[model samples]
Target: MTITTREDEERLRLLESVILNTTDGVLIAENDHNQDSKIVFVNEAFIKMSGYNKEEIIGLSPIGFFAPDASSDELAKLKDAIDKCEPCNIVVKTSKKNGTKYWVNVSVAPVSDGSGGFKHWVYIQRDVNNRRRHLQALEEQNKKLKEIAWIQSHVVRAPLARIMGLVDLLSEHHDSEELSNNQIIEAIASSANELDNIIRKIVQNTENVQNQSSL
Candidate 1:
């Protein structure tokens, strides 16, 4: 019995240590109407992410770290979900101690006692600023590529097609006896060469754009 009790205590201590040292920020808050939501627990990751110490955060409300322009409706919805013991995901901007705002993806769920009574709300947050920026850049690049395709299809190709057609007609009648036939043949050759050069340049430019986009 003594050995079993000691083993159980060691296991509990290890579990607590794991919870407190995880990389993802973890916060446990109690729902209290008379006072602000009390932060009962915060892990080391939460302290590092928020630049707050355990003593600074323990009795404070988590919402105080939210941006000043945060939506009340969203906060209300999150509170309602927590009250009903539902898990929910919300994206919001959070401010650090220096007032620098960053985007976070937060998931909240109810923590309950063994008897099914509400104990506290547990929130897990991850920083998503880099991912958001990459997504936005991809969107902008797609828009630019669409614009370039429109220009190539409409503006560049139409004129090239007309020049090629006129050159073909001149070449077909090159056996004419007229003295100006030689001049016409020369002009046709020049137009055909110029059109080929233009097409090649356009294709090369488009391929370069595509390669850059992939990178």
Candidate 2:
């Protein structure tokens, strides 16, 4: 039988106090290796995160915490790690008691008993829904920027080439046709220069935006 001493009890209480007040959600469960695993304890942070009381979740399998319809690869990977008694990290979506769904990063490790077997699992969880959304927004912006760049390269080419050819024709036939008035030739060249400057500004602005997102 194991003996309980005042010194051991004091140390245990100190550890419990730290877990109880931690910012990240902490959960300890019996390592039944699957949906059968039973939750043994949860910290205050976990209670707040899930909107569930200790009495409501304890002694129940964690299947209730995960959404039944969620069949994502991350969920499957977490299950596989548990079956192998290994440590794993994954971001998964779960529903609170009020049915409000959110994303969290779960880091779990198997705790071994002295007899070469895993007796329990320790899980640390933190919310990451906002971070995921920000990344998705950045991806969408990058996609649109790429489409704009492609249009500038292909669609604008024919018109710009035509402007260059017209300028060249003016230079060669300056004394040929009555249409080659000095004032008229100068106006056309000035207009072509303005269009070139506008296109350059658009390309430069696109590069600036792309660079900011990467940083």
RMSD of each: 4.5, 4.9
Cα displacement (Å) at residue 76, model 2: 1.7
Model 1: residues with Cα > 4 Å off, grouped in runs: 67-77, 168-215
* Residue 33 displacement (Å), model 1: 4.0
Best by lDDT: 2
Model-by-model lDDT, in order?
0.76, 0.78
Cα lDDT of model 1 by residue, 166-186, tens digit: 566676774555525566657
After superposition, candidate 2 runs with Cα above 4 Å error = 1-7, 32-35, 67-69, 155-158, 174-215
lDDT of 1 at 102: 77
Where is model 2 poorest over a 10-residue stretch in terms of lDDT? 62-71
The alpha-carbon lDDT assigned to residue 63 of candidate 2 equals 45
> What's the CA error at residue 62 for candidate 1, in Å?
2.2
